[model samples]
Every structure is written in C-alpha cells, then in structure tokens.
Target chain A: MTTLVSEAIRAPYDFLAWLVGLWSDALYAVGDALGIGMLEYVFMHHAFLVGTLIAVMAPLVGTFLVHRQMALIGDALAHTAFAGVAVGLFVNSILGTGISPYLTAVVVAMLAALAIELISEVTDAYNDVSMAIVLSTGFALGAVLISVNTGGLAVGINQYLFGNLATVSRENAVLLVVLFLLVSVVVTVTYKQLLYVTFDETAARVAGIDVTWYNRLMTTLTALVVVGAMQIMGVILVAAMLVVPVAAAAQVARGFRESLLASVVLAQIAVLVGITLSYRYEATAGGTIVLVAVAVYIGMVLAGKLQSRRGVSEEAGTGSVAREIDAGTGESTDD
Target chain B: MSLEGIPSVGVGGVETSRESAEAGEGRRGEGTADADRVVDAVDLTFGYAAAPVVESVSFGVDRGEYVGIVGPNGSGKSTLLRLVLGLHEPDSGHARLLGHPSLAFAERERVGYVAQDVTENTKRMPITVAEVVLMGRFPHAGFGRVTETDREHAREALRTVGIERLADRKITALSGGQRQRAYIARALAGEAELLVLDEPTVGVDAESVDAFFDLLADLNDEGMTILLVEHDIGAVLERASRVICLNREVYFDGSPAAFAGSDALERAYGTNLGLGAKTETDSRGDGS
Candidate 1:
C-alpha cells in the first residue's frame, strides 16, 4: 500500500525529471547556437530552471504576504528551514542513510509554519515578539546541531547558506517543480478567499470565509516556497525573492491583479539577469539576485513618485467632481 | 457568572416596537413566523475579559426597519455588532442573523456589512474599486468562477453608488466618503437584503456624511433593512426610524422620537450621573 502511494507521487516527479532533461538539451543547443558559455554546462541549466521556478512561486505567494504585513514571516520560515536542513544532515550522519536534506527541510519548515500560526492564534495577535523568538530559536537549533556534527557537513553547509549555482542537482530541481505545482494550484483555487482575508479580515469573516483556515493555508504555502527557493536562493537570502519583487510591483501597479502579474514579471527579470551577472562576476547567486531585486525596487519607487507627481493636478480636479456626483445622486434619491 | 454550562436565559427587553413584541414571541415557539426579523438577539452577552462588554442585549430588527444603535465609546456597540454578525461567539444567550444563529448562519450573501473605513488600515493594498466591489460576489461564487452576471451585478452596484466613473481607479486614491460608498457597492453586489454599517461616517466630511445618510435612507425606502451603529447621537436621532441606546445593556430600545423625548441618551451616555449610576448597578445585578 505504501509503495502504491509512493508510486502515485513518484510518477509525476519522474515525468518532471524527463521534462527537465529535455529542457537541458534545448538549453545546450541554444548555448551552442548563441555562443553562451554558461548554458553549456548541465548544472548551469539546472540552476536556470530552478531560478525561473523560484521567481514564479516566491513572488506569487509573496504578493499576499507583503501586502498583509507578514513579510517577516518568510524570513522567519527560512531560518527554520535551515534548522530543517541541519536536522537532515545530523540524521544522515548518525544513521548512514541516503536521505535528501531538502526533503527534511520541507517537513521541518512546514512544522515551523504551523507553530507560528498556532502561536499567533493563541496570542490573539501576530506580534513580532513571538515571530522574533521563533526565528532565533530555529537558527540556534541549526547552529547547535551543525556544531555537534562538525566535519564534511560544515563544508557542505556553505552551499545551503549562501547558495551555489554549480550545486543545482537534478533531483533538487525536480523537487522544486513539484513544490511549484502545489503552490500554484492551491493559490489559483483560493485566490478570491485569500485576497479577501488579506485585504479585510473583518469583512471577510462577515462574508463567511473561514479566515483562520485560509491563514494556515497561506503560511503553509509560504513554507513550501521558502524551502524550494532555498536551493538557489540559500537560507540567508531566500526571503528577498519573496519580498523585493512584490514591493516593487506595489509601487507601480494600480490594482491587485496587476500587481500580482507585475511582481512575477519583475522577479523573472531579477532571476534571469541576476543569474547571468553572478556567472560572469563569480559572485554568490543568492546575493546577486537580491541585489538585482533591490535595484529594481529602487527604480520602481522613483517611477511611482514621478507618476504620482504628474497625476496630482488631474486627480485633484476629478476628486471634486466625483464627490459632487455622489451628493447629486444622494439628493435625487431622497424625494 | 460561571463560565461553564450556563443555561440560555429567557428573552426580555423586546419592547423596541410593536413588531418586535410579535417577533420575540415568534422566536420562543413559532420559529419561522417572524421571517421579517433580520436580526434577533435574545439575552446576548459577551466580553474579552471578566467584565462583560455587552450584557443581555435583546432586540429584534424586522424587515425594512432603519435601526440605529448609539452609545459612548467602549460601550460595546462595535462588540455587539461583532456578536450579531457571528464574528465572536457570545458568552451566553443567542444572536441570530436572518433567523439562523449568527455563529452558524450559512446564508451570508444575504447580509451586507459596511465597516468603519477598512481602507484606513489597508491603505497600501493595490486593489481597484471594481475589484473590491467584485468581492461582494465572492460568497456566492464559492469555489466556482465569477461569471459575467457577477460582473454585471458588480457594475450595477457601482453605478447605484454613483462610483461607476471611478470603477477602474485604485480604492486607496479615493476620499473617505468615496471608500464607504465602494464598500456599500460591494455589499449590494452580493445582493444583500440586510445592510449593516458600523460607524460608517467616522472620518467623512460633514457634507458627505449628510449625503451618505441620504443614500442610506433611500436604500431603506427601497425595502432594505438597515442597522447602523454610530457614536453620533444627533445623526442617529435625525436619520434612523428606530434608535437603540446601549451601554453594556439595552438602556432604551424604541422609536427615535420616543428615544429623543426620553432621557435614554443621557442615561446611556452616562451624562446624567445619578440615573447612569443607578442604571449601572441595576444592569450588573441583572447580568450576574
């Protein structure tokens, strides 16, 4: 029965791996044609694939999180994911078993996500005090666990901490594809409810959307995104992908749907450009991506300021007209 | 006073109007006989701490009735609204919305809520006026896709509220009064029969407040049951057909004219120290 259930899940991952192989070949061909040196290597192909998926899902979940003032929750979850990776490494060393640390990280991060939700629910507020405590606790646990198993494990930890472009394994890329599918499908199904809850908790409740259930779902999805992005983004800089793009999008987009689309587009730019720049400069991929994202954010802020300044006079005139129309209709309705 | 296994108290203070007297009896045994009672609270009590914020507040709002609940700040007016909407569970007794217990009330689309300037808190959220209004149809659409008919209803609601021209504009860019209208349009798009507003004119300008009340009165005339909770006594007295003066309990529940004639406002507001002091003791006795 267990094998059957595992097979059901494994079949999709196998197909995704096959798709990734095809993508690598296509990239190789394109690299030969366009004379792009970086795309010639298989690891670089995996890196780009992983980076692209991270760009899509990170900001997709991040848009809701950023607007809701829960951006810190992403940073908190990433720290906990580091603890998860530490636990996986410790267990593997002790038991001499071949288990993926990313798999364990997913489990541990999801647990931390629920713990955060539970604490908030019990406290009757999402205070930063509890979040800060949880974050430090996760990091402390990871540090302590890693210190206890100090040798080859310490060397490999740098890849998880700062993120290495050359270390993008095929299996890790496949895991990200699965996470991407899960996050996107859930968000698509519950977009309206999530938007309502994020925008106005009271009205959403009165409208009969179970706000608590949706909040839990949101945090859990954030955990998945954090861990998946951890491969290319690393534990330290993973959260920037979740926040910077969304912040930039909010500056320019007029509507929620527009902001969501814009954030995803902006993140794609950050990821693709940052990856290329990282390869050329021999810089850390996560650091490069975050730097690019922040640069984009600065550009958007300036653009938003200029746009508002230009529209100020036009807006003032229309504002009065709108109010006058409201008053007129009110009087006409009063009989 | 015990927290556990407290028996539901019998209904009292149902004398808001002749209609409510009948509705109260309908609640006791006849059930569906008072289908017009859009909101009914029988000895409802709740508090965050030990001292109950709202205590034994019993009243019934029949269809098409314009009811206004006026009280001082921290007098549990908003908390009472939460109870009626089933946002918080009552410590005891029952609060019903459209005949169902508010907590378990399933037909949510029938009731509309216009909160006190939700935009003040969510000012930075990037949502257009059209998008916000479309949320009213969310309860109806559930997991299904929002159809063209839903969009049509949302558009009609925006037009009704006189913000059809500003449909594409961002909600945060609008003034306080305009934001409230957008919220009302959202409620209307859901085709709500009972429109509930909690201090809808908090930061609105004086002229817009008058216009907002006029719009509300017009909706009331069109057979919509309106329940408004406001701290402004004069506004409630001038606009609402029925007035409920509350401070921890139902100090007075009757017509606006009767409420104005009586010292209900003074007692409820605690302006008349002697009467207010006496009433506080009396309510505490009743609560315990």
Candidate 2:
C-alpha cells in the first residue's frame, strides 16, 4: 500500500521530468539558432526554468504579503527553512537515509509559519520581536547543526546559503514545478478570500471569511514559496524575489489586479536579465536578480512620481465633476 | 413602518425592554420573540482586559428600523457594535444577528458593514472603487467565480450611490465622503437586509458629511435597516428613527426626540469628565 501511494505521488513528478527534458531539448535548439553559449548547457536550461517559475509564484504570493505590510514574514520563513535543511542533513548523517533536505525544509518552515501565526494570535499582535527571535533561532540552529556534523554536509551548505545557479539539478527543477503548481492553484482558488483578508482583517471577519484561517494559509504558502525559491535564490536573499517586484509594481500600478500582473511581469524581467548578467559576470544569480529588481524599483519610483505630479491636476478636475454629479443626483433624488 | 404605530418609548422604557428581551431569551425558540428583530442583544457584555468595555447592553433593532448609537469616545460603542456583529464574542449573555446567535450566524451576506474610513490606512493599496464595491458580492460568490449578474448588481449599487461615473477610479483617489458611499454601494450590492456604519463620516468634509447623511436617510427610506454608530449627536438625531445612548451600558433607548429631551447624553458623556471638558473646549475653539 505504501509503495502504491508513493508510485501515485511519483507519477506526476515523472511526467514533469519528461516535460523538463522537452524544455531542455527546446532550449538547446534555441541556443544553436541564437548562438547563445549558456543555453547550450542542460543546467542553464534548468536554472532558467526554475528562475521563471520562481518569478511567477514569488510575486503572485508577495502581492498579498506586501500590501498587508507582512513582507518580512517571507524573510523569517526562509531562515526557518534553512534550519529545516540542517535538520535533514543531521538526521541523514546519523540514520543513513536518502531523504531530500528540501522536503524536510518544507515541513519545518510550515511548522515555523504556524508558530508565528499562533504566537501572533495569542499575543494579539504580529510584532517584530517575535519574528526576530524566530529568524535568529533558525540561523543559530542551522549553524550549530552544520558545525556538529563536521563533514561533506558543510561543503554543500554554501549552495543553500548563497545559492549556486549551476546546482539547479533536474530533481530540484521538478520539485519547483510541483511547488509552482501547488502555490498557483491554491492562490487562484482562495484569491478572493486572501485578498479580502489582506485588505481589511476586520471587514473580512465581518464578512465571515475566517480571517484567521486565511492568515494561517497565507503564512503556510509563504513557507512553501520560501522553500521553493531557496533552491536558486538561497536562504538569505529568497525573500527579495517575493517583496521587491511587488513593491516596484505598487509604485506604478493603479489597481490590485494590475499590480499583481505588473509584479509578475517585472519579476520575469529581473530574473531573466539577472540570470544572463550573472552568467556573463560570474556573480551570484540571487544577488544579481535582487540588484536588477532594485534597479527596476528605482525606475518605477521615478515613473510614479511623474505620474502623480500629472495626476494632481487631473484629479482636481475629476473632483469638481464628481461634486457636480453629486449635487445633480442629490436634487433629483430629493424630488 | 410597522413600528410607526408603537408609541415612542422614553427613558423609562429601558427597564421594560430589558425585561422583555430577557423574557424573549428565556424561550428563544418560540419563533415570536426575535424573528422580526435584525439585531438582538440581551445583556451582552465584553471586555479586552479586566474591566468590561460593553456592559449589560440590551436592545433589539426591528426590521427596517434605523437605529443610531451615540456615546463618548471610550463609551464602548464600537465594542458593542463588534459584539453585535460577532467579531468579538461577548463575555456574558448573548447577542443575536438576524435571529441567530451572533458568533454562529452563517448567512453573512445578509449584512453589510462600513467602518470608519479603512481606506485612509490602506490608501496606497492599488484597488479600484469598482473592486471595493465588488467585494460585497464576494460573500455571495464564495469560492466560485464572480458572475455577470454579480457585476450588474455592483453597477446598480454604484448608480444608486451616484458614483457609477467613478467606478473605475482607484478607491484611494476618491474623497472620504465618496469612499464611504462606495462602501455603502458594496453593502447594497450584497443585497444586505441590515446595513451597519460605525462613524462613517469621520474625516469627511462638512458639506460631504451632510450629503452622506442624506444618502443614509435615502437608504433608510427605501426600507433598508440601518444601525449607525456616530460621534456626531446632531447628525444621528436628525437622521435616525431611534437613538441609543450608550456608556459601557445603555443610558437610553428610545425615539430621537425622546433621546434629545432626556439627560441620557449628559449622563453618557458626563461619565468621562475629561471628554466632556474636551468637547466644551472643541466647541469653544469652533466658535472662535
């Protein structure tokens, strides 16, 4: 029965592997046609795929988080996910098991997410002190665990810390695909509830949307996003993918849906361009992507300033028009 | 208008109503007690800390009745409203919304709420006026797609509030008065039987505040039940059919005229001497 269940779960991953193979072959053809050196490698193809998916899911969840002023929650969860990786490595060394560290990270990060939520619920606040404690505890645990292991585990830790583009293995790519689908499907299904909760907790509660449950779900999803992005963006800088693009989009986008779409588009530019630049310069992919995203944010801020300066006069005109209509309708309704 | 025939209950009627509500709660399932009342609170009490914020509050808002709650700043008016809406569970007794226990009241779409300018805090959020109004339909839609009919209702609600022209504009771009109307439109879109507003005109310009009250009067005239919590005693007296003066407890529950005639305002506002002094100074400042 266990084997059957495991096979049932593996079926989708197998299909995703096939899809990844097809993607790599297509990239190879494109590389030959465009004479791109980096796209010739299978690892580069996987890196691009993972980066693209990260761009989509990161901001898709980040939009809700950033608007709610909970952007730091992503950073907090990423640190806990790192601790989770340490736990996995520690247990694997002792037990001689082949369990994926990312799986353990997912489990630990989700638990930490729930802890953060529960603490907030009990204390009636999402204060920075508790979050700081959680973050430090995670990094401290990871450091201690890595020191205690004293072997090849410490050598592989750099990839998880700062992230390595060349380390985007086929299995890691497939895992990300699964996470992308999960995050996308869940967010799509619960979009309205999540949006309502994020926008106004009191009003959402009044609407009977179970604000607490949605909050828990949101944090849990943040844990998943942090873990998935950690494979390429690393533990330290993964949250940049979730926050920076969303902030950039908020600078110019005039509506929630528009901001969400704009953030995804902006993240795509950051990831794709940053990947290419990192390859050219031999820099860390995560650091390059965040730098590009920050640059995009600065550009958006300037554009937003220009738009607002122009919007002032336009808004004054609309204000007068609105008053006129209000007066007209007030009289008509009275009559 | 069914309540029009009932004589205006004066200050003395508070005791009688409490007794009747208690009697009603004693035999709750009899079907005659609370079936017609949209909001029924019988000895409801709640507090965040040691001391009770709302204490032994008892009242019932009949169908289509416009009730306004007025109190001092810390008089637990908002807390009482939260208790009525089941956002905060009462410490003792019970509050019922639309004939069901407030906390367990499942048919949430039947009620609409507009609180004191939440948009002021979320001004940077990129949600359009149309989208905010569309949230009224969210409870109806649940996990399903927002249907065309839902959009039509939202449009109709916007038109009713006379802001259909600005439907596509960002919500934060609107004036405080206009934003409150959009919230009302949201409630209207939901087909809510009861509309609740807590200090709905805070930060609104004086001219717009008058217009906002007129809008409320118009909604009430159209047979919509309204429960309003306002700091502006004059506005509530001018608009509400019934006035509830509260200070941790119900000071008075009666007609607006009766409320004005009684010393309930003085008793409620006088409990906090600093607030009373501040009000005097504020009025003096306004005169100067």
Candidate 3:
C-alpha cells in the first residue's frame, strides 16, 4: 500500500528526474566541449547540484547575520550540528534504525539556535558570549559522543567534518533540494520584515513588527542553512560560505538588496569553480570552496580600496573642496 | 543593592474604553479628563539590579501638548520614555497609554518612538532612507505588502522633515543632522498621534539643532502630541508648552515659565541649570 502511494508520487518525481537528466546532458555537452571530463560523472553532478543549492542558501541567510554582526553564529550552529549528527549515529546504533544523520542535525541545530537566543535574552549576555558557550558545549558533546561510539561511528564522520564530494548520496542531494526550496521561500516571504529588524531592532519593535519573532525566524533560518551547507561545505568550513561571499558583496554593493544579490552571484561562481578544482585535484571540497570565497573577498577588498583612492585623487583636483564637504558631515561609523 | 523583584502594583478597577464601551460616552459627559490624556503614569517606579532608575514618577500629557522632559545624564530620562512605551515595565506603579495600560495598549501605530542615537546600530546597514521610513508603515501594512498609499505617506514624511531629496540615499551616507531628520521621518511616516523623541538631536550641528526643534514645533502645532526627552534645556523650554523636570522622580510638571521660576531645576539637577541664564538675561532687560 505504501508502495502504491510512493508510486503515485513517483510520476511527478520521474518527470522531475527526466528534466534533470536533460539538464545534465546539456551540462555534459558543455563539459565535453570544454574538455573537463570530471563533470560527466554522476557523483560530480550530485556534488555540483548540492554546492549550487548551498551557495544560494548560505549568503541569503548570511547577509542578515553578517549585517547584525552575528557572523560567528553560522560557525556555532555548524558545530552544534556536528554534535547532532553524533547523537543521531548513537541513537541509530542503539535502536537499529536507519535514519539519516543530517535529519538529526537539523533538529539539534534548531534547538541550539533557540538556546543561543534564550541565553542571550535571559542573561543579557552579549550574543557572542552565548555563541561561544554554545560552541564549546556543542563541540565537547560531539567529541564525547564520538569517543564513546568509536567502534560504530568512526568510519563515516570525516565526510561531514571535511566534506567529500563523492559522499553526497542521491538521497542527501534530494534532501538538499528540499532544504533549498524551503529556505528560499521563507527568506523571500519574510525579506522585508527581516531587513527592518536587522537594521534597527529597537525601532522595529517600536514599530510593532514582532521583533522577537523575526529574530527567532532569522536564527532558525541560519540553522537550516548551516545544516544544508554542511552536506557540501562541511562542518568546519560551512560558515565561510555564509560570511566570505557577503563580505565580498559588501565591498561592492551599495544597498542591502544589491549586497544580497551580489553575494549569491559571488557564491555561485566560487562554488562552481571550487567544485571543479576539487574534482580535478581530489582535494577536500569544503576547503577548496572556502579558499575560493576568501580569494574573491581579498580581490574585492583590493578593488574597493583602489576605486576609493581613485575617487579621492579625482577630488584632490578640486583642492580641499571635497574634504570640506566630508568634514562638514561626520565620517560614517557604519562598520 | 540586592537584585530582588519588586512587586508591581497595577492600577485596579480602571476600565479601558473597550471594557466600558457602553458607558464611555456617559462617562465623557461627567468630564473625567480622559479625553486628551495620551499618557498617564501614576506613581511609576522602575529599577535595574534593585536600584531604582525611575522612582515614583507621575505625569500626564494631554492632547496637542508638547511636553519636554529634562534631566541630567543617567537621571532616568530614557528609562521614563521606555516605561511609557512599555519597553520597560515599572516596578511599583502603573503607566497608561491612550486609556489602556501600556502593556495592553493595542493600537501600536498610534504612538511613535524615536530612540536616542540609534545611528551607531543603523549606520552599518545598507538601507535607503525611503526604506527606513517605510518601516514605520509596518504595523499598518501588517503581513501585507506596503501599499502605494504607504509609499506616498513615507514620501510626504520625508518632505515634512525636509529630507525628501535624501530619500534614495543610503542611511550610512547621511550627515548626523540629516540622519536625525530621517529618523523623525520614520516616526512621522507612521502618522501616529503621539511622537516620543528620546534625545533625537545629540550629534546634530548647532545650526541643524535649531532647524530640528523648529520641525518638532511645527509637528506639535499641527496637533501631534510630542513628548520630547531632551538634554538641551534652553532650546526645549523655548518650544515645549509644558516641561517635565525629572531626576529619578517628577520634580515638577508645569508650564516652562513656571519651571524657570520654581527651584525644581536646582533641586533635580543639583545646579541652577542653564535655563537660569535665559531667565537672568530676561530679568536683566525687563525686570519683570
């Protein structure tokens, strides 16, 4: 009976599968023309798909976190997710269940996110302190869990730790697709409200925007993005995707929406190129992706400095006239 | 000071207009003085770490009144505003906003608040002036997209604050005075009946400070009840119809002239405040 229900669902799934096949064929044709033979493998296709989805999600959520100066939240959540994965493994061994560790990571990461928020709100502790406490606790828990379950769990944990491209199973890729859609819809629907809260939470509260709810929504979304990115970017380097692309985007973009858009574009470029490089060199996919993102960030910083210097030089032609205007208006302390 | 919770004694048997809707019109006939009172704080007391910041402060702001609250630094000026806005709960007494207990005040859009020097928090955000102003419309928009009417109101608010030209400019790029104006525009865009400003001109240039007060005076003249918490006693006294002198308590609540005449300033601030300068200068010329 369950098979019949699945069969009914299989029709649309098969249609989707067929469409994905057509797209993959087109990508392969491009790869053949470009002479990048690694792109034709089924595992390579999975890696690229997961990477692209992660690229879209990381910066979409990261821009808000970065702007709020909570960039380390992604790192904290990722480490918490590692503990969650350990719990899943331990529980599965005990119960003889075959549940995916990523599922448990999602649950654990979300709880940790809420815990982070609650600790800060209740104690009036700075957000970083909350993050630091949670980070240490989470890493310690994961380490203990792994040590205790060394016989059963030690084999497959490295894939989550450093991310292996070949380890992104079809089921995990499908899960990532679901996560991408969920995150995209949520972030899009709540974009304006989140932006309002992100800019000035006190004013947003005064404006009756349910600031706490949006804050929770943002942190929850961060947890979800951290889990999704973990499949490809790994536990350690997942947050790099969240922060580096946004840092680069901020150097170039003048507005919030522009920054968000540019970050996604930058992340996409980094992910695709990183995946290709990792595939060719048999390197850790997460590290390669982060390295590319960092390189782009450095490039943007240099470019921004050069562009501003040129502007200053052009203003120098007008003597102290430009300087006078700038002096009249106090320098911005935005960063 | 021991960090112990003070028992909050809420006002009892005070019927909200909603609860007593059937008899509200009849009560109005009895002249209970509830018609125009935007804020009515009765013996409000708040503290942090069991040390009182606002101690048994009470004041009422009637409709169309510009009330300026003046106090020395850390004398609970901002804390008093927070109590009225329900951002902080008073420990020992009650505060009502628009005839409802502040915590239960449902008409959120009716009261607007401009916090002190939020520029530090907002500067890093890459938001445009219009977008910041549009946030004022959030309560009215309510899970719906901002309407064209909302945008028009935001634009009009910008025009009112005389920063309509900077509407498209990023908030981080604006001058201190311009940012303050933009914040005022954000509050104004809500079209609230009561505007609560907490030191809205801290970093403004001298020339712009005069202009900022002029804008507030203009808003008050147009019937928006303004509660301004200011450190610039002289400028605020010149504009506000009533002055509320607070130093952890309500020292005086009366006309600005009476505030000048009374020793409340000296008692509250522990000094004859600079408003004395203006008072002495006036007496030197007219001896009245």
Candidate 4:
C-alpha cells in the first residue's frame, strides 16, 4: 500500500527527493574537501535542514507571543503535542495502523492552542492559568497513555521527549518545510495586524480589527511551529527555542521588525552551533540547542546593561571636553 | 458622506434597513459625515454580573463637543467609555458612535480610544513611541504595510502632542507625562474625529496634567470631538464645553457653566461640593 501510494504521487515526491539529494551531495562534496564528512549522512542533512526551518518559524511567531505576554503558551502546546504523539502511537498499535505520530501531534497541538483561547475566553481565568491547566492535563494524559501502552509502542517516545537528530525522517522533513512556509507566509502577510494587536489589543479591537480571530490565528500558527520543531527541540525544550531567541533579540533590537530579524539570525546561529557541537560531542541535540540559546540570551543581557550604562554616563558628562574625550575613547575602544 | 448608511442594530430602530446600508458603507473608507451626535447613549445599562455597574445612562455628544464625564470610583466611567467604543455590549438600551449603533459601528479609523492603565500594560513591551503611534494607522492599513502618508500622520500626531523629538525613544524609557503624550499622539495619528480617552492623566505629573488638558483644548478647538472620562472634576470643567456627571445614570448633561451652578454636583458628591474651578481653594478646604 505504501509503494502504491508512493507510485501514485511519484513525480512530485521524486522531484523533491532528487532536489534534496543533489543539494546534500553538493554540500557533502564541499565538506569532504574540508575534512568534515559528517554532512554526508542523510539524517544529518535532515537534522540541519529541519533545524534551520524551526529556528526561523519559532522566533517569528514567538516575538508576537512574547510581546503579548503569552510565552508560556508555547510550552503548553508542546506538551499537548507530546500527548498527541502518545495518542497516535497508542492508536497505531491498537489498530495496527501505520499513521505518523507527528501528524497527530500537529492536530492535537492546534486543538490545544484553540482550547487555551476558548478556555480563557469563556472563563475569567488568566492566560497563565489556562496554559497551566492545559499543560498539566496534557502531560498527565501522556503519562497515562505511556503507562497503558503494553504493546511496546512507546519505544520512540524518548526521541520525542529529549529529541534525537537522527530521528527527523525525510517525510517529517517535508512536513517541516511545509510548516515553515505556512508560518512565514502567515506572519509576513499579517505583520501589521499582529503588531497592532500585540502592542495594544484594546485599541486594535476598537479599530475594528477582529482581535479574537487574529489571536486564534496566532496561537494556531504557534502550534504548527511547535509540532514542526518538536523533532529537533523536543517537547520539554521546544518552547525555549521559541522564547529565548526573541528575548535575546529584544534586548538589542530597536523595533519589532529588527527584533524578529535578529531573533531568526540568533536562532539560526544557535541551531547550527548546537547541532555541530552535539554531533561532535555525542550530546543530546535538544539540550545542546537550548543551552546555546540560553548562553546567547545571557550574553545579550550583559551587553544591553553595559550599553545602557554607557548611555547614562555619556548623558551625565559635564562639558564639550568630556564629550570629546568620550568620543575619542569610544573610537580607541573600536580599534 | 452622509449618515444614511450608519448602522442601528443595538440601538434597535430601523435596524434591518441599517444592516443592509452598512454593508456598502463598511467598504467605503470615508464613512458618514457629521450628523451632530458623535456619541449617543440611550438608556444604556451594563454590568459584569447581576448588579449593574451602569444603568439607564443616556447622553448625546454633539459634533465638536469636548464632553468630560466625571464620577466616583467604580461609577462605570470606564465602562461607559468601553460601551461607546464598542468594547462591551450593553445589557439593555444602546450606545452609538458617529450616529451608528455601537455594536454595528465599524468606522474604526474615524474613532480613537486611549485606555486607562496603558502605562502598566505596556511596561515590558519593547515598542518605540513612533511604533506605538504608528499603530493608530492599523485600521486604515489593514493587513498591509504602513504607507508614507501613515508615517506622516504619525509624525504630525507626535508634533501635535509636542513629543516629535521623542518619537524614536522607547515607550518604557519615557517619563509619565511623555508617555501620556505618546498615547495621545497614537490616537491623533488615526485621524479620528472622536477621541475617547479614559483617565489619561491618572499617572501624569501635575505640570503635565495642565499641558495635557491644554493640548486637548487645542484639539477640541480644531474641531475634534473629545470624550474624556476623568477623575479630576475641577480640571475637566475648566476644559470641557459640556460635562456629563455619571453615577450609573446621567445626573446632569449640559454646559460646564450650567453644571457648575447646578445642584447636581452637591447631589452626586453627597455635599455642597464646589463644582467651579475658580472655587478650587474652597473645594479643597471643604474636602479636608
């Protein structure tokens, strides 16, 4: 049946397969001359490609979420995706189905995202309360399913928990690409609306923008990002990738666009460095990635404090001679 | 532009006809022209639960009227502003904006609102003053990028509030007065005719309060209809052409001089509280 389906959709899949194959082989050839043949493996290629995609997707959505003070939602949805993966595996073993758990994760995570919005809307609960409710419920359900799994279907659960670079298959890589494009397009198209809602929701609402609908769109997009990133970032650290990069960028970036752009650049660097270090050191990919992001965040915080202090000192300078001395010292330091 | 297509849904009068007319007007960038009333509340009642916070409130804000609503704490001053802004649906009766019922009113660019507690809400947000002001153009721009004209409007608004120099400064970095001016600039940038501000001077300094009221006066003189929900009754009476004293209902709706001389203030304040700004010393003395 798998072969029949592949044959039916052969042309497009073949094109994608060939394109990725050629791209990876070209990179491997370059890596061979540099004494870095690690890129030769198909799984390594998948890890890097999917890792890059997640780096872009996570922070792009996370910027708005962070500004709106809904950062915990990312973690909540990631846990829900974990439960979703458990449910998929459980159902597959019970029914002898060959369904992909990642697909189920996407469905479950999006529903949970909507659920968070609905719960907050219907009740007077704070956003964090709703998030905590969903978070605990999701993890508990995952635990229950794991405990109930007598058919040994939970074997791959560890990979989803802490993440393994080798586990991101070609099929899931394709899904990540689709998710990346979807998230990017949505964010780019609705950038202004998102900015309005993020900065001042009441004003945005009065301005005739459908605040609720945009909010749901944002959360659903976050769910997509989480599910796509879960393979590389894992359920536990998935939200770190979403938040840490944006937090670091916010320390320095002057505006939202700059914040988003800088966050993507920062996340990309973290993912690349983390993946390479993990491959070299035989470390867990998710933990390595999140640690790198945290380091970057710390570095940015220290730099921001130093910059603000300098600004204050420059303002407190007495006269033109002190200002000239300050400029000279600044230029000398630049050297 | 005429009020022919203005919606009347929540107001419940010829409502179905308004629904059909609004479908066309909603697309038109320029909505209805002035039909006198910028904000019209007729027997509006609202509450979070069983006991109504505001009940049987009724008033009309004529075009170019700088109407100040004054009330005690929890007297539904903010809620009434929310009702006029279409943030909350009333339990009964109706509120209208630009001659359209609040629920169906969708001419967003024509109206701007500044919420209370904005400074607290935006404490950690990393947006600049210009960016905050640029948000006022969101309604006109929709899902699109801000145009040069939008930028110009934002700059003009900043100039109007005398904070043009601080446009690039981060909102969190501004002083309380500067922050309040930035908020006013945000509302002005939308090119709104009706500006509804809730407690804009709550956290501002004493000097900035005078400047802020003066700026509001300048805007009102320039033909912008202002609805200010203020705690400072004496200050509001000095600036506003009309005063609406609300304690869940319209106690008095008339000129500042009329409200100053009327017994409505004594009744609302439960004493012979001086409503005149000139009697400031006497009022303060009486309160003490």
TM-score of each: 0.92, 0.92, 0.86, 0.88
- The lDDT values for all models are 0.86, 0.86, 0.79, 0.80
The C-alpha local distance difference test score for the whole of candidate 4 amounts to: 0.80
Residue range B1-288, candidate 3, lDDT tens digits:
000112221221122112222222333454546767888887788998789999877667778889899978899999999889887778988888988898777778788888766768655666678888888887888777789999999998887777776777677767677777788788888889999999988887787677677777778877889999998777766788777777786665666666666566666666555456546524533432
**CAPRI tier for the interface of model 4:** acceptable
DockQ of each: 0.59, 0.53, 0.24, 0.25
| Residue A114 alpha-carbon offset, candidate 3, angstroms | 1.0
Candidate 2 stretches greater than 4 Å from native: A1-5, A325-329, A332-335, B1-34, B271-288
**What DockQ does candidate 3 score?**
0.24
The worst-scoring run of ten residues by lDDT in candidate 3 chain A lies at A326-335
Q: Which digits, one per residue and each the tens of the lDDT, describe model 2 over residues B1-288?
A: 122222223444455355334433533444444467899887777899999998777787888889999888898999998999999888897888998999998999899999999975687899988888999999999999999999999999999888999998888888888889999999999999999999998999888888888888888888899999999877777778777878787766776655555555666666465356445534533443
Docking class of 2: medium
Per residue, candidate 1 scores C-alpha lDDT tens digits across B200-248 of 9999988888888888988999999999998666677777877777788
Lowest summed lDDT window (length 10), candidate 4 chain B: B2-11
What lDDT score is found at residue B24 in candidate 1? 35
Indicate whether candidate 3 or candidate 4 has the larger lDDT. 4
Q: On residues A189-296, what C-alpha lDDT tens digit does candidate 2 reach at each position?
A: 999999898887888889999988998999999999999999888999999999999999999998899999999999999999999999999999999999999999
**C-alpha lDDT (0 to 100) for residue A102 of candidate 4:** 92
Candidate 3 residue pairs that clash? none
lDDT of 2 at B252: 69
